[model samples]
Target chain A: MQITRQEIAGMDKRFRANFINSLSGFKSANLIGTVDMQGISNLCIVSSVFHVGANPPLLGMIMRPHTVARDTLQNIKDTEEFTINHVNSSMVRQAHQTSARYPSDVSEFDAVGLSQYKSTLLNAPYVEESKVRIGMQLRSIQEIVLNKTELVIGEIIEVQMDNKYVLEDGFIELEPMNGVVVSGVDAYHSTQIIDRLSYAKPDASASSIRGHAK
Target chain B: MQITRQEIAGMDKRFRANFINSLSGFKSANLIGTVDMQGISNLCIVSSVFHVGANPPLLGMIMRPHTVARDTLQNIKDTEEFTINHVNSSMVRQAHQTSARYPSDVSEFDAVGLSQYKSTLLNAPYVEESKVRIGMQLRSIQEIVLNKTELVIGEIIEVQMDNKYVLEDGFIELEPMNGVVVSGVDAYHSTQIIDRLSYAKPDASASSIRGHAK
Candidate 1:
């Protein structure tokens, strides 16, 4: 089936949301943890996390700040800190539960029965169950004009993970941690590695690096 | 192992790239097809494609326009059109090869041996081997002042896919299309669905809606 611009603009609101979202393909399932001045912890699932830079260790995520994620964006702005914890397959159900519209007074961590682990350097709470955890400091917010969504860029202040998950070459293996991916609006997925390929070159097809190392 | 901001900044540049890149979890693997003024197809791999909004069916991606992706960015800026194609497990090697630094005069489509399927609505070329294809028109470019990279936002002008991949609820099933996710910088992995979950609500744990249907 082929859908044109005019046809897409005319799609049912909810259907168009699911369809357009899926077009972006698989996304990182991360539970972004934050806290207000009163210390009411907020945890919400975000799928737009993408690497921005490395030397500064920055990551970026897009959020409709005025909608379901208003609290997350607000908390980050007030505290200038947050924790990004990867949602694994085992915690998928609980992670998805964070999206529910909870009142500002109620902590999603308490509502969903997930433990909040506070790191030493940041006020943002981390998911104790997550194998991969990152603490972020708000760097910049760019307002998207066409859509009101804001692009939140954060600098990675700290990264905490198990030794087994971090390989010798600094590549963090997700399979061992049981990391899960999100598709469209409400679908979750598990991935199977197809072997890491060596750096590409114009002269030849890339070769699989055994165990991600030479 | 726990890594702090200071340590990350001091690590080897390449090592830091691999380490920090993995912290974002998984990303969508896409082969972006664009063409020059002379119709020389430029295909490149990008993992940063993300859903911006649904009403206008917008998608956004991050690219370092001044670097390896200069050709693709230049073509899109000049022509204001591009095709974003899913990179399945089978074509992952070819997709990765597009990242190789090719001369501006040479088309990556010719260098990589992928057939270019031109859609009537846009000047860009699509990958015939891709099961999920989307034609995008440039909407706006936001310069990420933190890094030199620019966020390219595109309106989803057209979508083409098999009927089977499009569910009744409008969720495009990527697993059926053999869609793969990328981690770090060079690793590719195929996904397995864990079933779509019901929309979250405050009252209960989200139950899996079998086959993405109620």
Candidate 2:
């Protein structure tokens, strides 16, 4: 369809939100993380999380513009540390509860019935019930003015995972965790391993299509 | 299980690889519009892009990092204009081939098999095939310390997307596009629609667990 610039701009504004909604619709789990600042704790749900770099071990998450002060952003800013916990089917409901914006002084950990555990190297606490947790240090923060959003980049400092999800080579198979994927907004979807393509760089040999279709 | 700082760091490094690998798995489609001080033209392709916004939209992507000497980045520096297109299933193959690294003067539309269109306000071009795109003006360029990485961030000026993908009240419905999800290093996963969640604001009304099964 021929979409104009105005149409596109209108759609761009809702893309992430709709994607998140589509994602949440599946009743799939959302990525849940906990942040603590000066003893104030908060739980935040994010779906715009993605890896930014590998060499420096970085991950980036785009946060919606905060209409009010947010504990997660405040915590990260204050402590320069945070924990990322992978949400699975088991923690979907509790994770949803954590999305509630409680007072900065209140702990979402208590509201969600999630146990907070001290991170290995960071001052923040992670969700004990989460199947996968990674301690990260703030590396950068940039504002997306077009959307008035914030992108948080964190360098992975540590990782905690249950062996059941780890492969022999240490690859974390998120499948069993009932790993949920987010769409635009408010949507939660489950991930199914459809096809595992061979890793091929642009300089490498093109993938052999024969016997490779899953 | 408890994880140590050193152990977490080790896992963090490896997980970083997997995370980036997963991102690489999904092909990114964007318009490489060029302006030779006067005219603007759009080119489309799927690149394994990365974000460098250590601060706020200080976004960056690893092109051939060498490709910068060519047209896109050159144009951005000369005119400080560019755009980002988020690819969906419809243009998967088209976006994939746009990464062929054509000569500075060669347009991917001619090199690859995709069509291009001009932008409205920006002098750059937009991929007719992409469903969503962000128009930006160049902010800065930084070369990675030891790697052939060129970090580029632009001020987002415009966002484009299809109207159907947009819902009333400005929510984007991304599922119909059959948005392709990425995993590993080259795997492209198709999405399935599920449920949508309400925005998880501190005071947003709590979602009902009526249909949810733990």
- Candidate 2 docking classification: acceptable
Error of 2 at B191 (Å): 1.5
- How does candidate 1 score on lDDT? 0.90
Off by over 4 Å in 1: A212-214, B212-214
Candidate 2 Cα outliers beyond 4 Å, as residue runs: A1-38, A62-69, A140-151, A162-176, A193-205, A208-214, B1-16, B19-72, B100-105, B119-123, B133-162, B200-205, B208-214
Question: Over the stretch B135-204, how does candidate 2's per-residue lDDT look in tens digits?
Answer: 6678666553333455565655565666566565444555566556555444445555445555565555
* TM-score of each model, in listed order: 0.98, 0.71
lDDT tens string, model 2, A1-214?
3433344345544443343233211122334354564576676766546555566666666565563226677778777887777776666666765666677677888766788887547678888877777777888776755445676778777767665544433344566566666543345555554444343333433343323322
DockQ of each: 0.86, 0.26
Clash pairs detected, candidate 1: none
lDDT of 1 by residue, B1-214 (tens): 7889998989888888889999999999999999999878899999989989998789999988776799999998999999999999889888999998888889998998899998889989999999999999999998999987899999998988997877888888889889999999999999998868888899888998856452
